[model samples]
Each structure stands twice: as structure tokens, then as C-alpha cells.
Target: MAKKSKQYEYDLSEVKRLIGETDKNYREIAAETGCPYASVVYHGRKIRGRVNRMRQEELNIEEQQPVLSITEETTETPKMLSGGTALSISRSDVHIHDAEQEAAKMIKAARALGLNKVNITIDR
Candidate 1:
């Protein structure tokens, strides 16, 4: 008589939820779930396929409805700034002292705008 491998009982819904919520790779999910990486990939793919089919059905229902038109008129006058206004300082015009001041100003501005990283590229 052949013996069956011990199966770990877990909520399939929870497994699917974790996999969808995180960007973790299959191996990471397998480690966390105590399942084989292959199984994780297989089950995850199955769950995602099912969800996609359900979404397609919902979209088909929505497509049967008539589309509504939306229009809005602007009331406020548009204001435009001319050249050499607010932070229009050119890189060529930047001296060592000016660069330091500009760097400080940029740091403050970036923090205010909640920027995580900034990339600057110079072209000749």
C-alpha cells in the first residue's frame, strides 16, 4: 500500500490574497506559506485566472450600459509666467556659490513636493 504525502491545510483565499497584495517572488511566497515554489506558482496562476475571468464578466455587463457625456466650463482667468521667473536659473549661469544656494533651495523644494528621488541628466 502507498502512503499519501502529508498535506498542509491552509485557506486558499488567504494564500491568494497575500500573493496578490505583495510583490514577493514565488520562492518568497513558498517560504512564507511552507509550500513548494512550484505549487505557489501553479495555485497563484489559477487564482489570478479565475479573478480575471470574473472581471471580464463584470466589464461585459458594464459595456451594455449607455455612456454619459460630461462637460464643464472654466471661469477663472489663466495666468502665465514670463521667462527668468521662479527657479528658471540656468545651469550654465550657476557659479560655485550659486550652485550651493540652488542645491539648498532644490532640496527644500523637493521635500515640499514629497519627492523620493530626483534624476538630472545633462546634454551637450
Candidate 2:
């Protein structure tokens, strides 16, 4: 008579989640979950690799799609950027996630206020 091989069900997702989200090490996770140390290490390495790939993909996407751009205002108008009054981006909530978006808004405001533009420099 032929017998089926034994199957063991283990939740590797839990280990992967801990590795990707928490600061816990593989040894700590293995100890906490009673999973084999080797299994934990293997899963941890795989999770980290996947995360790195995901981050790289995100960066590539960002690079492919420009964060900011100006399409020519397709109509007869005053010479574009035709002003002498130079204004600067001077103030805002410096701590922000999307600095480019904030700066774009500031520049748009400057243009509305009849400014060609001057400089955008940050210093410590």
C-alpha cells in the first residue's frame, strides 16, 4: 500500500510581517513563535528582499512620472514669465511629505501675484 507524505502547515506570513514592519530580529521572532531558527532566517531574508524590490519599483515609477511640469499655455498671451518683480518662497510648514507639491503651489501663487520668479534655495 502507498502512503501520502506528511504535510506541515506553517504560517510564514506572520514571520514576514514581523520582519517587514517591526524591528524584531529573526532569532527573536523564531523564539517567540517556536518556529525553527532556519525557517525564520529564510523567511526574513525573503521578506526583506521583496521590500527592497518594492521600494526600487516605487522609485522607478516616480522617476518615470515627473512630479512637476509646465505645459505651454496654448494661446496668444503676454510673453511668458514676462515680469521683473522677483519673489521668493519664504515661508511654509517646512516639515512636509511632498515638498515638490508645496513648492509648486508657492510658485503658482507667485505667478498669480505678477511675479516672473526669482530663486528657490534652502539653507540650514
What is the per-residue lDDT of model 2 for residues 83-108, given as tens digits with 9 covering 90 to 100?
Answer: 54334445433433366666788779
For model 1, the superposed segments whose C-alpha errors exceed 4 Å read: 47-124
**What TM-score would each prediction reach against the true structure?**
0.33, 0.32
lDDT of 1 by residue, 1-124 (tens): 9998878765667667767887666677787777766777787777555444457577678656643322222233322234423222224434333455665665576556554444332222
Q: What is the lDDT of residue 62 in candidate 2?
A: 69
- For each candidate in the order shown, give its overall lDDT on alpha carbons: 0.55, 0.62
